[model samples]
Target chain A: MNAVFQVNNLNKSFGGLTVANGISLSMEQGDRVALIGPNGAGKTTFINLVTGHMPPDSGSVALRGADITRLGPTARVRKGLVRSFQVTRLFSDMTPAEHVALAVLQRTGRSGRVFGNFGAMPDVMAEVSEGLKALGIDHIANHKVSEIAYGQQRLLEIALALALKPNVLLLDEPAAGVPQSDTSRIEEALAGLPDDLAVLMIDHDMDLVFRFARRVVVLAAGTIIFDGTPQDVAKDARVREAYLGNYANARSSV
Target chain B: MAIQRAIAAEGKVDAGPNWLLRDLMGLAAVLAVAGIGYLLFPNNLALLTRITAIALLVLSLDLVTGYCGIATLGHAALFGSGAYAAGIAAVHFDITDPFAMAAVGAVGGAAAGLLAGAIMLRGRGLAQLVLSIAIVYLFHETANKASNWTGGSDGLAGISPDPVFGIFGFDLWGRTAYVFGIAILAVVFVLLRLLVRSPFGMLCRGIREDPVRVSAMGASVNGTLLRMYAISGAVAGLGGALNAISTQVVGLDSLSFTTSAEALVMLVVGGTGSLFGALVGTLTFMWFEDFVSAINPFHWLTIIGALLIAVVLFAPNGLYGTATQLLHRVWNKR
Candidate 1:
């Protein structure tokens, strides 16, 4: 399989503390991958650096074999690498449909249009439908994002990235805010995604990480401890020690 | 496509009127009302004319402070520059045409916006506020020191704007001035209405709401903000030019911190995020200022300060914002 995304010798430091240290990984097209780590293991920071939310101290990220180290998030998104926020990053005032419509608008290569009469735009409704349907949110397209339930809002954020019609989707801790019962719902949505969309998700939930991801990459102390199949990662002594260490207390509280 | 209808069944249109038409109809209504108002009270026509000019000024402020979310207190500098440019052109260069005054106004405002935008881009929030205050004081002192051209502390006069379009000569009551001001205001409102609702406007709001996200989106969010500042300046400058032409005088008051503060209060009172809010705020404030002054001498400053504080604390959204929310609540109740 051809590699869709490649990260090389990534390192980032915030003040005196190192966040991502010499991290190297790759994602194959159609690969369902989980980036698992204990809290503060630099999973989110690594994702942020790849998506250009923050820059790596020294490293390179490539999408479709082309370098995107200096590209901004939107430009990176345009080139088919998009990531969702850990906390829902949505236009709260805007409806679910409007949120999707704006994403669709960006994908259309339209110039920045903060002030046009977008009401008359012909494809707006269609774009909203495509996005909402992807996440089974067609029923709440017109609802204000703020008015939606917490689980639904999380779904809406995923729908927003899906609306971008992205080739590669990066979901940062999708299951973080979801309740136990609703987690199954999120799992179902992840399971139902077509093979065409390659999703690189970061999760603290070991079950979803193991169940959904065909491949799992484990990080501990800002370094990749293991990158292999779920069974292989589960068997790895290093990953087990990282989680079975002080994380035993951390894991039980959740 | 059918899925969209299904989605629509879930939620209704939550926004107010469609943007472009709302502005056109709103401004047209303002002009019509002003015409009727000035016609009825010919004596107060001059004050009403000044109010219309203030409405325009507030509209410009809304662009910078409200929409773009840029805190600007030095806009008074741009307004003062426009007033000075128009006054000098008329008093010294023998160019008294209203059109010439408008051109000079636009250029003066654009220049301030460009200079200020370039510098302010490096500084946000309190830094911007400090820089803006400095600019205001700098211009005020410059105008105060330039005695010959600006008339120094006295202010430059002899504006003598020849009856707009060379028709219906300038009367003592300033009827012709009010009409011309209202007409130009109509045009400005329409142009601005279109510009603000455009994609560029949305981008501005996107940046205003979350600059970090905007920067990530591959757009130079700061660059876009800088452009917005320039546009705000040009529009505000034109508004000041109108004041100079209608009054036939340019005062150093244009550069005062009081002028900047008043503009802010007007924006908040009128509802900052929109054009009509600016109009309504200015009109209401002018009425209160003029009429209240008749009953008590120090009504304008005292009431405006109190009103601003009340609006900020109680209303939060100000007049138009509160009105919109109230309407939404009512609609939901029904």
Candidate 2:
């Protein structure tokens, strides 16, 4: 069976610094993987390379057995390879409803309609409501994104990614910058993601990572140092030296 | 649910049943204002007609710059192309019909837009601005060098448009021209109102704020922006044809750098995104210019400069945008 997402020897570099060095990874359907690394360990770079935001110097990224390395970011998204940014990238003046509505329209190929308003389309609105409600942000859907809290903004990002009905989701630090008090809300949203959808989340929070990931992949110096069950991830010697270090000991004890 | 209720309550949404009433009211408001202008400036109809044409140019600029965030200073390329196409059609091809000339102008403008959009959309921000400036110069030089068709720097002349539906003739008093210009403006204004409120408009708005995010949502940012540019070109072209038909002359000044810069200024002063703001800005700026220049021709430019500075400083969102914000606040307080 073809893996839902496969990356083969992905290589990228900026001048002398290599961001992705021969990174080979694959995920099966329903995989819930957490990608954790140090600040400069190229986690975000890997996501960028796979999602087609940045071109790979040498490698191939495939989804459902179809190679998509040459495709642009927009085309990759249309093929159901969607991602969320670490920093919440949203339309500030637009409402959450507008964002989700646009996503739904784009997904269904109706965003180019120059004559009709999305508000009048009952089917579109129904899906928008459902998506917002699923993220527990339906009540504030009508409010402008600028007026919403940062935590809610993060949730909106996830909501946007999910609206595409992606087969493989790459979430770049979904809970970053969100308050500790609001972290649970994000975790809840993460937990409630569709069961059969493959999710690859990059996060720094060990607790969230350990709780959410079925398998954890650790990267250090643009190379995958560990790829195993969360339990074994903390015990891996290379992972301890490169990333986990003292935290791995503490995490294993807990 | 509350979402449905909110959608319904939101005035900008739901372009279906309510749009007829809204559009009719908008049309009525525009005609009423035109009627007042006609009553007040019966003798200055030519000036009013010119304002109407420039207003259309500013409106088209708003679509790309204001809505899509594609900063351009070569919009006059599209406008001038329309004027030249209309003039050439009438003078050379014997297409004397005003409507047919407008159609030719629209096609001309759209072609310019496609060419300009392809080049401009390649680079963003300062690069995009520079490319637009370059394009306008190229177009200007091309127009100048093609003397036979464009009449060189002497300007394209001998453009005579047929009467509207074989009834109202293009007269010396500029009466028919002014009335025709207002009628066109009203119709275009109404259609644009619908265009900006549609899903496509929302997509452009999304692209304006965060194009990267829009792309992640599976939209081709350049493609969407290019399409908008073409539409903008068409509107500007229509205005150009109107000018050609009204004045029976097409000049090199229509394609000049100053025309593009002035259109940008008018759009900014009126406010960028709002169609109403475009009209308001054009009317306010042109009327103030005419009113002041007529009094003191030499110092008029300085006064206009001061007014622009004041508007940018106090009303950073442009006159219409700032006024609406204040009105909203006041209404909320009430």
Candidate 3:
């Protein structure tokens, strides 16, 4: 099977510290891959390198077999490789509808329209409403992003990434700061996403990782130590010692 | 059942183009002010005309600093470039047609904007602020040194623009200039109102809030901001051209730092983000200056400073922004 995304020999270093060390990975279409690791395992840096947020020291990234390593973040996004932020980067003064509408407008190549009222643009508004509804934030579409709860903003973060119509999505901790009670909503939103889209979610919540991901990749000391099915990840000794030991023991104790 | 009902209701409720109504009202208010100015200050039409020209400058400044969130104190560089361009075109080229001169001024201003935006965007926050100030000083010195073309410190003279469409001469009564200024202001205002409500405007607003997020959404933030600066320069150039045509001269003061600083103060006083706020701030500040200086001549600046401080404290969004918020609250209650 052809891979939709391929990373070959990516290397990134800050000073002498290697954040991404000769890492290589690949994802097929419709893959639900969870990247889990202990803190400072270079998961975020790897995501950054893949998404073109920063230039990797050495490596090449390919989307659909076309080289995209040198492309900027915006260019990568236009090529259908979109990412959500660990911290929701939303306009505080604008409403959720405006944020979603902006993404939809950019997706349709109409964000440059300077004459008509964007609110009056039918396609943009429809997408905005639909995107918001999908994230369960439709009721607060008119409210400013600042007025929404932190959990809602986190969901809006996912909603914005989805609005770009990404073929491959990189979600950087979608439920990072969300209260436990509110995480189910994020899960529901993720669960409802299209089946054909590839998603790589980096979340510290193991429950979310295990429940949502069919395949798991474990990063340890800037390298992938484990890559297999979620069931196999639980059984793998390296994954337990490196990252999943706490979750495995907790499950047994419970 | 409740969810279904809400969804059905949402479908029926159109967010419709409410801005069209706001635009019409804003135009009416502007025209009404012009009419009032004609009646009350027939003798002071020059000052009123000057206010109109400065209003355009402040409005243009709002586009870059307010909408695009590009901090600039060298905006007067664009204005000065336009003014000098129109003055030179009228003097050396004998291009006396007001419209043609305005067009020349616009081109000059846009060129200055493009150059300045490229240089200034390399820095952020404090560095950007310093760069903008440096650019303004550079423009000022260039205008001063190039005495032959720009008339140097002595100022450019002999700008004799023809009548409006060959029908009305720019008479001593200032009727033609006043009417011309108001008409141009109205057209520009309407265009800008439409622009700020458009997708491009929303993108600028997004850039203002967070450039990183805007880029992540597939926009080139620097390119968008550069385009915004050029458009702003064009608008300011039109204003500068109007100044040359109406005043019949261009002075070094056009490129001065004071002009840039005053424009920023006016924008802050009016409310930075809203076009109406720019106009309101210009009117309030200029009128206050004209009226108070006429009365107190020496201590007027102290009064103006006090007023600015009061505005910052009491009406944080400037006069129009604060007033609208108050009105909205009252209307909601009703």
Q: Tell me the TM-score of each prediction against the true structure.
A: 0.90, 0.96, 0.95
Clashing residue pairs, backbone N/CA/C < 3 A, model 3: none
Chain B TM-score list for all models = 0.91, 0.96, 0.95
The alpha-carbon RMSD over the true interface for every model, in angstroms, is: 3.5, 2.2, 4.2
Q: Residue by residue across B1-334, what tens digits does model 1's lDDT show?
A: 4565555545554132444456667877987887689767888888888887777778888887888788877777777777788788889998888888888887888788787778777888999888888888888898999979999988888888776667877778788888888887888888887777665776676677767655444456777887887887788788788888888888899878889878777777878877878887888777877777787786666875676788778878888888889998999898
Instruction: Kindly report the docking quality category of candidate 3.
Output: medium
C-alpha RMSD of each candidate structure in angstroms: 3.2, 3.0, 3.4
Query: Pick by lDDT: which candidate is best?
Result: 2
Candidate rank order under TM-score: 2, 3, 1
**Candidate 2: pairs in clash:** none
Error of 3 at A187 (Å): 0.4
Give lDDT tens digits, candidate 1, residues A1-254.
67789999999887989888999988877889999888788887888888887888899999888999998776887888878778877666667776666666667755365455444465866767776787887777777777888888888777777767777888888877888888877888888776887889998788888889999988888899898898898788888899887478786888
lDDT (10s digit) by residue, model 3, range A1-254:
68889999999898999998888889988999999988788998998899898899998999989999989899999999999999999999888888888898898898887877655665666777788888889898877888899999998998899999998999999998899999999999888888889899998888999889999898877889998998898888887797666566567999
Query: Candidate 2 docking category?
Result: medium
Instruction: Point out the higher-scoring one by TM-score: 1 or 2.
Output: 2
* Each model's DockQ score: 0.42, 0.62, 0.52
Question: Model 2 chain A: which ten-residue window has the lowest total lDDT?
Answer: A242-251
Instruction: Please provide, for model 2 over B1-334, each residue's C-alpha lDDT reduced to its tens digit, 9 standing for 90 to 100.
Output: 5667666566344436676686787678778988999999999999999999888899999999989988889999999998999999999999999889989988888889989999999898999999999999999999999999999899999999999899989999898889888988898898888888777899999999999889989998888999998999888998898899998999988988999999999999989897888988999999999999999999999999999999999999999899989998999899
lDDT of 2 by residue, A1-254 (tens): 56999999999999999999999999988899999887688987898899887999998999999999999999999999999998999999888888898999999999998887778789888888899999999888778899999999999999999999999999988999999999999999999999879999999899999999999998988999888999998788888787555467558989
Better of 1 and 3 by DockQ: 3
